[model samples]
Structures are given as structure tokens and as C-alpha cells.
Target: MDGNKALIAYETKGGATEEAAQKIAEILRSKYQLEVDLVDLKEQKMPDLSQYRNLVIGGGVRAGRVYDKVLKFLENDLSGKRVAFFVSSAQAGTPGSYEKAKIKFVENTLAKYPKINPVATEAFGGRIKILGKTVTDNRDMVKVEAWAEELGKKFTQ
Candidate 1:
């Protein structure tokens, strides 16, 4: 839809997921001329879904599940909207456990979305820095970027 509004909400542990969110927002903006709202989940309110026709959420996956805010957003009434989710984690591999984890998250959400369904969903690999104050662990920018690009396409679609 022309002139449709898109919102991308994100929760970042060390900034990687925030980057992914921005990347997806950029993709949506560049290709569709849509207004994109990038919200930091930590500080923002619960979000009113009635304002926008399209929405995207990205957050860091720690331990297993992603940030709590993103999770809450998922439970909202999405109904007939176009929506997607992207996550950043240390488990990214060339079809390894991390990929499995993301896929599972996607599948489960999709299956459940019929109850509160969106138009689509996506998951992107995230990074962690092994030695930094604000970030540490395993940093995989390449993997994250690849997913971000793909996610961009998905959002546009």
C-alpha cells in the first residue's frame, strides 16, 4: 500500500539487534517510501497497534527467548496486519542450532498467528562481542547482515 506506515520496535543488549532493526527500517523506507518508526523496547510504551498497517520487531535472544518487550508485542492483536520479527543471537551457523532455533520460533509464531495472525514473520541472526564493556561474546556481523538484507525483502514484500 502506498504511503503506508511501518513501525519497527527493537530491544538490544549491546546494540547489534538495534542495528538489525535499523537496517530493516532502512530497507522499508528505501524501497517503499514508507514512514518507519524505530522504537527502543526498553523505554517505549506497550504500543498501540491501531496506528500502523505494517509492523516489525527485532530483539536479542538471550538464553533462549528474545527480549520480554518483543514477546509482549507478539501477543498483541495483530489480526490482518503485515508483521515480521527478527532476532539476534550467538547461535548462528550455516544451518546449525541457531538457525534451528530461529526457524522454530518462526514456525511456532506462524502457527499461532492464525489465532492472532500477521501477514508474515522473519528471524535474523545477531552478533555478540567477545571483549567489550557494552558488548561481549560472539560477534557475527556477516550473518546478521545477511539476514537483515533478507528481512528487508520480506518487510517490503
Candidate 2:
């Protein structure tokens, strides 16, 4: 509650965003020994930011749109906090589309919240669904772990 604690708040469409949040929490807890909380944007309200030392916020993208709740959270006062933002989308994991996805996410989300300067930001590949059928999953654990690890290091520094 006081030190080495982080909150990972996220919104999901088909659970990809939630999965990414959980993976980040797991990596932080296991590798960095940090206490991480995974919050579902739809099910729970935002906790007091003053309680945590760091924050990680993410959302899933659908049809080039991000969840409104994720954007709202970014509107908060995040100065003097270590923060990171990420997005999960089908295009994010594609070979040539990842850069575009990152640009789109930053332009749409991060650009709107210029006050919230994240130490690290990324766009991860998410699962694709067609008519409720799983088409593709591009979530990479290696990437997730590395990002999470870097987040921990930022806090320690």
C-alpha cells in the first residue's frame, strides 16, 4: 500500500485487455515482487491514486475506437506518478501494423491527455473474433513481461 505497489486498470471488449492486465500484474508480482492490482473498468471504480506508487492503464481497441472509460481515467491528475499506457488490438501484433497501431493509440488516447506522461507506452497484439469465434491471438507474453519489468525498474530508480 505504501511502496512497490501498482494498479493496473483496464477495459476490455472480448477479455483481451483484461488478459493483458493480468499478465502485467503477474509479471510484476513474480519477477519484481511488487503488489499489483488488476481492476476491471466496467465492474469496479477507480481506486485512490494516492495509495499506489505507480499506475498502468490500458484498453482494447475495436473498429479504431478505444473504450471511453480508459480515456476518462487519463483525464485525472497524474503528475509525480510513474505511469504506463498500453493498448490491445488485432493490428498491434501484425508485422507491419504495430507501428501504425501505436501511432493511432497515442494520437487518440495519449495525445488527448498531454498531462499524463507515461514512462513507457505500447500497443500489444490482441485476439480477433469473428461472430464470437476466435480468429487470431497476437498477445505476446515476452513483450508483456519485458514491459512490466521495465515498469518495475522505473519505480526502483
Candidate 3:
């Protein structure tokens, strides 16, 4: 693994996951001085993972489950990589339900894949729309940026 290379791969339904992935990639590149590659798992084939020292995977949640693409991606052998995971969910954005959402969406989900030991993980708020009208906008970019900053430090360390 190249110590300075990182990959941010994600799947998004309502665009929240992709937005978070972009923010993370930006921070890793600009602040950490890392070579970052952003991949939309829905649109592109998975790149060769051997080139990256840090791997950040994320997806949006709906109906109490993380996106299928991200789950499938997690099936890869991610040993010896600095892995980080995140999810975007409406429940996570709610103050009262944040912990439950993290457990169900991030912790419990990652538990199924024993080989993946993430250096960091988080659950961010999501957005919901109905017929092109915004209904719930719970995304917090500041929180996302803060997580990325911490993740950058972990990756470099």
C-alpha cells in the first residue's frame, strides 16, 4: 500500500453519501496532502485496491438498511488497510436516534465482516425528498468535515 494514497468509494441514493465522500476526499487531498481517488460505486468499477493505503467506504441508508452496493463492496479482503466507514441516514441526524442509527447502520453492519477493522467510523445525517421537493434535510457538513479531519490524521499516522 502506498502510504500517501487513499480511496473514497461510496454509493448514494439521494446524494448525501456522495457529498460526504467528496468532502472527505477534499480534506484528505488538500489538508493531508494525500493522493485521493473518488469512486462512485454505482457508476464505476472498483479500482485496484492494492494502490491505496487508506480506504474510505460509505453509503446511504433507507428502510433500515445500508445500500446493497456498499455491503457487497465490503466483501472484499481489506486486510492491512487503514479502513474507515460511514453512513448517511435520517435517523442518524435526529438527536434522539443517533446512537441507535450508528449501532444498526455502522457497527452492526460492520460486525458481519470480521476482516474489516476500520480505523474510524461514523454515521452522518441524510436528506429525504419527495417528488423533487425537500422533505428532510438533516445533513451536517460541519460534522462531516470534522470527521474527515480526524480521519486524515489517522490515515497519515
Query: Which is the leading candidate under TM-score?
Result: 3
How well is each residue in 1-157 modelled by candidate 1, as lDDT tens digits?
3227778888898788887677767766786667788899898775566877777777777777777777776777776666766666666432457658666665554565456554445565555565664343455555555654654565556
lDDT of 2 by residue, 103-157 (tens): 9975567887878778899898999888999989988978887888888788667
Model 1 ranges with Cα > 4 A deviation = 1-3, 93-95, 109-114, 130-157
What's the TM-score of every candidate structure?
0.75, 0.93, 0.98
State, as a TM-score between 0 and 1, how close model 1 is to the true structure: 0.75
List the RMSD of every prediction in angstroms. Answer: 3.4, 1.5, 0.6
**Is 1 or 3 the stronger prediction by TM-score?**
3
Q: How many residue pairs of model 3 clash at the backbone?
A: 0
Models ranked on TM-score: 3, 2, 1
Candidate 3 colliding pairs:
none
**Cα-based lDDT at residue 103, candidate 3:** 99
Report lDDT (CA) for all predictions.
0.66, 0.86, 0.95
Model 2, 33: alpha-carbon shift in Å?
1.7
Candidate 3 regions off by >4 Å?
A: none
List the pairs of residues colliding in candidate 2: none
Residue 80's lDDT within candidate 1 is 63
